[model samples]
Target: MGYTIKDTRHLKNILRADFILGGLTAFTGLVFFRPLEGFLGLSQPFIILVPLANILYATAAFTLATAQRNPSIPLLRLLIGANWFWTLLSVALLYVHYTNVTTFGLTTLLFQIVIVGTLAYLEGNQLEKMA
Candidate 1:
């Protein structure tokens, strides 16, 4: 079935929210990489690189959000998939680094996982509704 205008708007809003969040995360990570590295017991490259990727993700999200047509289902699925992937990776990272990760780092990672997982769930639910 075709999407309604309301559905498009809702999808756009969700993507826009993701864009803002990704931008913020990238900014914070880039700005505090050194401090984060020291506090999180994670490498500086990992800290720097993830934020760079976040910027790219934000860009894509912004583009998708501003699209003139109905939202692309494939792309939306990709975004949701990426979010889930990120959430899983974070959990794995937390497990791998459990020996060295500080409490602050653990909390930060957990927060990220929760946020991303929620976004994924929300996006997936919207997709199902659209379907």
Candidate 2:
């Protein structure tokens, strides 16, 4: 009889973290829409844009996680880049919002930093193991 080693605990943790981050990003993006709209007092098509931005960020995070799981997979690298891109964009947006005296921007910025920073750490660990 032959035994196989399939220790996927680390992978599972990565996936769980990614999922949580992705969900949070999506939620934040969605929640910000209403207040942003009221603050900006925008109407019609403009109001919808905020939610779309959130959805895009969520999509990027999802794709990034998929790529992390299979590093060797073609296009995974691109997805990873996209993930970081959106995260940084979100950070910048938060910074701007806070600078303009928007409430909770500080909290959002902190959460974004922690979540994205943790993802970066996990990604580094995965890459180290693969190497």
- Write one digit per residue (lDDT tens) for candidate 1, span 45-118: 98898899789778878887998887777777778889999999999988998788788888878998998888
Cα lDDT tens digits for candidate 2, 9-112: 46445645666666665575566666755464334254355356546545644554565344342333344455566567657766666555334545655676
Candidate 2 regions off by >4 Å? 1-8, 36-72, 129-131
Tell me how candidate 2 scores on lDDT: 0.52
Which residue pairs come into collision in candidate 2? none
Error of 2 at 37 (Å): 5.3
- TM-scores vs. true structure, each candidate: 0.87, 0.55
Whole-model alpha-carbon lDDT for candidate 1: 0.83
Candidate 1: where are CA atoms >4 Å away? 1-6, 129-131
Model 2 clash count equals 0
